[model samples]
Target: MKRSLRRALWAGAVVAVTVAAVPVTTAFGAGTVTTTFTKAQDWGTGHETRVTVTNGSSATVTTWRIEFDLPSGTTISSAWDADVTSSGNHYVAVKKSWAGGLAPGASFSWGYNGSGAYKAPLNCTINGAACGGGTTPPTTTPPTTTPPTTTPPTTPPPTTPPPTTPPPNTGGKKVVGYFAEWGVYARNYHVKNIQTSGSAAKLTHILYAFGNTTGGRCSIGDSYADYEKAYTAADSVDGVADTWDQPLRGSFNQLRKLKQLNPHLKVIWSFGGWTWSGGFTQAAQNPAAFAESCYNLVEDPRWSDVFDGIDVDWEYPNACGLSCDTSGPNAFKNVISALRSKFGSNALVTAAITADGSNGGKIDATDYAGAIGNLNWLMPMTYDYFGAFNAQGPTAPHSPLTSYTGIPQQGFNSDAAIQKLKSKGVPASKLLLGIGFYGRGWTGVTQAAPGGSATGAAPGTYEAGIEDYKVLKNTCPATGTIAGTAYAKCGSNWWSYDTPSTINGKMTYANNQGLGGAFFWELSGDTSNGELIGAIKGGLG
Candidate 1:
């Protein structure tokens, strides 16, 4: 029965979107620009405006463009950029390109000369959101003539302790940074930034891969392949170090070098994913052997030092994975217990569990709350509900951090998942919110804005009709927030994703929930300057 259920879930996730008239939006994995306009200011004379755009999305905004409809009676005259244009009242500001992209947390400013008194535009759009009304700067006052008469009192001096060594900066958050795995394949350039941003100093763990599984015989899937590519690529970098390096090539080896660069970073091997999870059933049949195999593989003398922990990513145990196993409700807990007994707490033991919270859905398949007490942290693979996969549908939400109107997949969103886990007995601090680094959508969509669907699945490298979060922030920003997540439409396509704006909100939610921290799917999927990670840090702050 479990095996059958797992197979059904896998079948559901693997199927392509049915053909439809509208274009389907991509999944929430890539195409999220972290940079957003936070606060905007206006100065007179073509009014110099100050806009605060922060990087919180998965990727950086290399060249940001701020466009808004200007008020009538005002025309852009002399401009600092000098290349901006005025379409009636509409004004568009483009980066010089030479300034390069703004790094995460980094801000950029430009001013324009225009006619008429400076007044905020009636309609304002910053990073695609309706910013409401413009703010007015406070007035400054001139000096007054009143004189002071009171004198200061004298006091005794105090002695200080003998000069002792000072402690390090030690930031408030322990796990401030985590590297997602997808970056190993496509955007391999960021491994260095992870090292440079002092992220290594603050980072405690790294989670690789978006969605994949323990294929036949405990073998991994495409995510492993991507990891191999990234591992090999790191070898090309002269003097680069990794924490999980063995003489043989792999992310483990590359991570070894990364650790050498920053000894604090911990690399853990995660198995099982949203796809290809059927193998867990087979492994569960011989949990002891499977656990032994994992121990040997992770602790192999060559790269043993690099691997500080092991994470079981079985989508769910006993219940089902991408495929199912009939080992009974206790199968998942047994497998995890076996792993824990074998590896012990000296090495980290963690897992990513199912977020579905329905009465008899995936949540009931296994004992999540019961299992979490023994593990260090529980990561919930949030996001990816309404995409091309459900083409020709009442568009459901994939990763709604919270609940909202028109959410087809009501209880399955992130918030419900976390709440359900907590209600089941999992401690809030033991939980980590999982944020998608990409967007999910279907092409051939017909609706111009938010709620719409595609006639069928659109083309994609791994999954049909889904795209990375980095790509969609610019292509299809959410018209408004749904639940805690956001959804938007571009042309006929419909998309669900988190932007720098929404990520900030998610971070706040995580802090409010007392979650251990947040984790994204893969690292390479984010922008070059490390925007998403920056948001994670700032949000924690």
Candidate 2:
């Protein structure tokens, strides 16, 4: 589990909604166009707002421009889905080139993050008509002629950019990304980033990682992160501050709001990852008891609506992972069978299995094919095949698509795993190729090639030997491609990981093989603008 380095579970950290505004409209020569502004979220310091355009006329509207005025203290910092530029407190927004024209009854939306508290825009107009379609409603006007009797603070709270969503489409393949529960702490990544970075728009489903499997039963990984930490209005998904009296707050509440924003997206609670897989041994002892506990927890009224299904990420079933499992090959199949019996047909039941495809390896240690009838999909962890785990020697790519000459291991690559599983009766469509969003590195390397020797693991921001693609994309870009993976020889530090180009190649292979879509270990690895995920979505198409 190359991504398992992130299993550093620590305590959780603590971390908001706005009013809906009415829309106005105007009629152009081609058709009638309408624009509406909504205050999506409001923290004391910053806020997020959205603008929606709709075509209400009989004919197709080719284009539109929106202009609006903000109060002296409010300003637009950043926006997405549309091109927006501002001068002083006045702003102009034009449709993006890719958005094209709107047909009859069509609606389009874009948004921005702003400075200061939430304040509705004024003098808003679409084309030449008042937004929403009628006369502008009257409102209290600021006294411009005379300065305010009581001057407010000269400096406003620091402004932050808000979420900007594009039109959602996945080209029919499932794009799943993991959102670590502990990320809110040191990583400072929240549910809102998923929407703002545009990953939310590209993703078909989100795996809320590692709900604890301690005691052979499902449990909360972090109380604060799971459903207790209060989010200020500014940090919230919908811009509504969390209340003490509310039934749920933390990421679960934020995920609820995220679902509202992106109705096409589904969230799954994933139990047991690398650090927690030991519990599966006990869980396998009585699969029925374990399945019942998971069902009760996933369906709890407190956040029953937050999840669409369950995903089991047992590191290795009936085999060795972080710790060894001697529960027998039938253990995995039995557990999945019980889960399907409990979760029923509507709920999605999925699993992430080992990628050790070497003959007589972990792939053969469990009855994976026997559990397929109960699973919606199976994710073969394709990365982590080779890394700095063996501190000294033979630098190799962590994720290789094919077996290359002088490869350190046979049947350790992605193609080998996929082929091995297929040979065992698993359907190509039921298997999802796993991509790692990070890279593994080693220091004290003599040669840049795969056969070089190394002294130790390279230093990283969070852990040794592992770093996010976001940092590696700049710090140590790819210098060579071998075994269908990218490697960088920056100084004595040699690192190997997948790039967008490499990911595109893998996606092409996925399509050619008539396999299911691709999934990554996590989300925060991508660029802030979602460059890597964009490549995955584009490649899948």
Candidate 3:
């Protein structure tokens, strides 16, 4: 009789185990990928927390499925990266594209919009154990601190809050440029060249791009390596190791070197690009929490010494970029609000926004003028007029400041964009005119001078029909100006841009219009001696 009962107990245990496995379906089916979640601290206002995911095991992770179960009382207000679906208290993010199927040892990340407290997951399972994590290690909670029984009166006298320093004078012109650290390899330029060439000295603010926001991770690419080398070169010039690197080193260290050389340059980290901007829509839900997380990462005493400001280079806030963000008009303002509250007035916050001037482009999707009210400046990328995208007969003007007859694309150029912004209530002093140092042209066109028919757009190294400004200056000289902007003609093709002569005209316009100043696409695209910056300085005079 005892033996019979033992068999029955064994059978019951088997049944219980089968029931537990019911909730676990094949973990990762064919072509499916998985992502796990890790929580981090929220620094302050205008910040959000970071979540990292690692792809384990051998198979390719074509697409990822991430499910975040928020703790009680905490919630998501916005999200960036993947499309999200929430039920009860659980938030799930899914990838739209396979993204080349992450290889073994590859990892991708995403961020969350959360509020209140943060905690680690109690029950977590990612694509089988081989793909990683089924059980979390037990964590020890620290004992609560006891307050002193009888506190003495605090020392009465102390220092007053320091006076706010006046923002550095931009000489009535906001100095701006895209500092491509990677140019060290392909274009061969250094940050010091920016300094000695008067590029750094005549400037007001600098944008150090692309730390990558798509994966919700802060990583340094090869370009970061080049930036490091540039800093080393700058230090050699000063003959002293930068005093700023004591706290943290890296790109920020290089920025410190630039500052030491000029004492006037302000560096702002620009997050996201055409490729990485999709995550921002997700991050917008919990705008406050997301801003707090960004604050911690940017000012994390670890690298705080290197940065004086933060800039959002989100391609579009409400509409679409390389990826679409349908989060609505308030998404951008909400995010910027969180940042301003957390960082206060001390840290500079700004943005680069859409320049599409058509009747129904990105500008129509959101209220940009309102969002930039608190910004130090607004940069409109006013180039990329015509490329191989339109392979038709009527070759249009690539960089015309204003619309003209025989132009290929309708209602696209700098003038329409500027007028739109001004009409929308954006103060002229807050707007910085964007100038491209390069030219866009078509190669197969047989016509001569400014207007002609083309077979296709000129081919480019990275994108179709684009060339650096420095190259264009020598290849094409100015033929005329439409409205304080320059255009030129090459044999069988037409190009538009601002030379030193035309840059002076742009600066004059900025001054007359009470506009902030002029900014260019990049620093390396200028002449070896930085003639563009010189023109800006000279023109502002």
Candidate 4:
């Protein structure tokens, strides 16, 4: 996702409140606190809850605690953003160390997952004072009770099937590249560039991104650029011009020609992205329907031969991305399982997921390991861990392969995420290490090393704080290395990006770790001569 879009969504608050007899308020020393309980997501057997505490008084609140009671048979399974403890039916929540202080009018929220029926908490209290709210009314009992009876079954139960194991690595490494659909507009990067740059011969798969996930169904992102636009004979790969009306004439036809030139290449249509992932929540509601829509669109008779399979790019499922999702941990597994069932074992199925490896981070928010069996591979987005998003000093590398002494954040590096996923039961062979062909840096830096202070984001040709390696490599050549990555400080302007030398080191790490292979964000970032792509092919070999 773009940093600007992420900031816009984060600024917009998503709050839901339940009305009570009186507004919940509690008096403390020199201040007052009001807490609101909202249900984020609710299914039959499980649900998610969010509690927001606001400082309503003039004084700042340095610390806080909330206590409440749950209905009978309800139990908390997991929680985040706060420390929670339960005893019998009573639960107590304390603010996390990082979220301890709140200025007046500011609010902090924490969420949890629970089992059994959803119910608003009773006897809510903040600090030691009562929150002026009445308890929920008790359920009414039936006048008469009947004994339960059981009937014997005439047939025996069916046996359970054994779990399926993922296929072995077999020593074949993959080199996957993503081709953006909209790149043909302003970027003017045609499919022929792959052949011209020598990337066509090295690539094993080309993921055409991205098909849209709209209205809870798979849809074409850009019809004109995908298969409608006409190409001149000089621009066409096969040197054939399209008539005024042709069934397929756009990038689809060009990619088919490219595949013929490189017989080992496979093309997969990737659906959903950071901006389009909002529809995955609705898709999870009916996985079978979503799968059917995807199959039809990917295998459309118009250009069915263009795509070999499908790739789902639901960013940070059941967690925060461009939007927040409370679809529960198993939502990703259910969706992928449905796709596998619909597409069958022979068809390729894969996904691009979050690389957050911190405690209770995004990796812990979804069951990626459980869904690995249904996937051909999983791409952990190891880049974009940090960027101009912070917008201040403490400049750090956005895609470090390993950690350094003064790394800005913990568990944000690629190695941390890869190891975490492997520890969680995902086979190393099914996980592909992600590499970014771009660089993220800041300007106005005094120090050249990794923890330098910066004034703001560095300007780029298109967007600030980000630029393709093809542009950055010559503009600001790397001067030093840290934590197994490259950095450059050219006249007070600091930049951090992966160089050919650093890419070789990362590839060696992947091989030693028994990883399947490597994949980059997009092919357009490489130089016209395919310098970066050549390095990747050479290193992987």
Model 4, span 276-370: residue lDDT tens? 88889999999999999999998889878888889998876888877888999999999998898787645678888888877778888999877
Model 2 misplaced regions, further than 4 Å: 6-169
For model 2, how does the per-residue alpha-carbon lDDT over 1-541 read when each residue is reduced to its tens digit?
3354532110000112222222222212122455555554555566556566656676777788888888878887656546788888988988755455776666665666577886777767777665433233223222221111221112110111111121134444678899999889888889999999999988988999978888899888889999999999999988899999999999999999999999989899999998888888999999999999999999999999999889999978877778888999999989988887788655778898888778678888888876764666788888888778789958998888888887787777888888777556465556778898899899999798887999999999888999999999999999999877899999999999999999999988876654557889788888898888888888888
Model 1 scores what on Cα lDDT?
0.53
Superposed Cα RMSD, model 4:
19.5
Q: State model 2's lDDT.
A: 0.75
Q: Of models 1 and 3, which has the larger TM-score? A: 3
Where is the poorest 10-residue window by lDDT in model 1? 155-164
Model 3 lDDT per residue over 27-130, tens place:
22122233334332232221133333434446666666655465676776544334567887876666523124556555444444355544433233343322
Provide TM-scores for the models.
Answer: 0.62, 0.70, 0.64, 0.70
TM-score (C-alpha) between model 1 and the true structure: 0.62
Error of 3 at 363 (Å): 1.4
Q: How does candidate 4 fare on TM-score?
A: 0.70
lDDT string for model 1 (281-342, tens) is: 77778787888877876677866786666777676566655555677787777777778767
Q: Rank the candidates by lDDT, best first.
A: 2, 4, 3, 1
Model 4 misplaced stretches (Cα beyond 4 Å): 1-171
- Write down the lDDT that model 3 would get: 0.55
User: Each prediction's Cα lDDT score?
Assistant: 0.53, 0.75, 0.55, 0.72
